[model samples]
Target: MAGKSQAGGERIEHPFDPLFNEYSRVLILGSFPSVRSREQNFYYGHPRNRFWKVMATILNCPQPQTVEAKRALILEHHLALWDSVAECEISGSSDSSIRGVRPNDLSIILKKCDIRRIYCNGRKSYDIYRRYIEERTGREAVLLPSTSPANARCGTEELINRWSVITKDLQSQK
Candidate 1:
């Protein structure tokens, strides 16, 4: 949504809009975009990220290979996606390197969508939300194990199991 800056080798702004709609029933938050995501201008663009795979497995849908397909999969299933840090100085895509955080305004999506549940993609996102957005939104986000490749300790099947919680929300919407 804004220009990217590499000053001090830290990203200064979020590069894309949050994905959501009036009918969206669930909101998923990541801490921030990875370098690959920024380059592709989409969420979880890294090939090794297990987000797409875990989503497909839990939703019982085909893995989305294109940005358009990814959007379709999320929107069609009443899920919304966005990041917690709107502006941050970080070294590459390392969440631990993030600092000077300016959290996103979730009301932009919350006002438009009937989101019933909020899910954080990892501990970083959960921590950020709890620290910055939770008081403002008055909603607690469920922490899900990260699907990032860096989280090798949690395999895809385990991620699928943990992420399966969202399906109940989605199914209830139907």
Candidate 2:
């Protein structure tokens, strides 16, 4: 899907609502949707992103294929998912090329859920959240490595090991 042109570049508006409910206990954030994610209109739509695999391994659930299944995997585990950015100018799906940021208001989810923790899927998301949302919420966000295929140095196993921290908070709430 093509984004709107802005200042001789493409500016994409986040196309989906945050996945969460009153029962959600953990909030997981990404910087913004990738081109593939935007095309599919879901988070981590890229086949090789490894987010679903990591989550499935840590949460001990099957890797979800369909959007509904993914939603179920998140909500059933008391997790919420969203991006830190509401809209931005990006080049193709490159996080390094991202600019013109407008942050999403996380209060919408925070207000409705008893979120015990906030996690950022990558450095970009963590940085964006800290810069834009952390002060308002007065919450610290844990930064996890990027699950994008571009982050090849951190394999699935390594990602799972790092991301297992999510389960700590999830289990504590249970």
Candidate 3:
């Protein structure tokens, strides 16, 4: 249950959209976007969040400094985005409290694409995916450290280190 925000003087719909396509080789899953993300209408729009920065750095892509550019960067890299839950009853955006979670129909991707890898953006995504859909797909997933600033237990350098593995695959393709 979410209320329309009066901030920014605009109405927002679908605060967080999992970005992905059939051709997408990588999938970035965020638990859910914050109110600010909904208001801005983009993924990881929060300046402090490092998902884009970490991925861009890993891929050696020009760091996307703006929201539109970030979208372009992901598409340019052939990555797809989709939340683990297709629909859920959530109080605010906290992943811990998401209830009645229903996973998005992934058959579209399975039928149309050659998804080489399914990388959950963080542990929450991985946990949900593993419980809800992984067995059905019968594919192993790689759990990347959460890029959310909320996960301050780990340092940025450490996060970058874990993320380098994903980058290495892209480099090897070259």
Candidate 4:
């Protein structure tokens, strides 16, 4: 949980493993885990965060309310989930407060999965992915409006519309 210092504050190391499997075809990355997520030891643990709802709407599945259900959803859709930052100095959950970022080595999932497409959940994540992972992997990620509660500018409907792209190719195949 303790990480290196940056400026005056302490950075926090990412505490969980990336979620994926050999069947994974799409990769979704966030900037970093929020404090609530860190406490819950799962992605998008904040109640107000709409990530699970948005994904459920796009995939035509019931929204997940528990970690087990969330994992099931990701596995069922052949999607991988992780964060762009392996560690960073952040004040609360604000992406703007992030500094001294150490990006995650996404090759853990990339090497194990087919991972046809990558999608960043927010601007910070998108920037981090482009700066670190994209060049190394030669895989460009699509930017999706964040489902974070902080991103109130994008409504639930808009998020679903934008996020539907993740399932578009799969839907066509079915």
- Alpha-carbon RMSD, each predicted model: 2.1, 1.5, 4.6, 1.4
- lDDT of every predicted structure (CA atoms): 0.92, 0.91, 0.70, 0.90
lDDT of 3 by residue, 1-174 (tens): 343333322222344555656556766666656556766877876777787778887778778887778878877777777667666655555566666667766666766656677778788778988998888888878888888777888777888789888766655544
C-alpha TM-scores of all predictions: 0.95, 0.95, 0.82, 0.95
Q: Model 4 Cα displacement at 133 (Å)?
A: 1.5
lDDT of 4 at 36: 99
Best by TM-score: 2
Candidate 4 residue lDDT tens string, 40-100:
9999999999999999998898998889999999998888999999988988788998898
> Which one is best on lDDT?
1
Runs in model 4 deviating more than 4 A are 3-8, 172-174
Q: Candidate 2's C-alpha lDDT?
A: 0.91
lDDT by residue (57-109, candidate 2, tens digit) is 99998899999999999999999999999998888888888888899999999
Candidate closer to the true structure by lDDT (higher is better), 2 or 4: 2
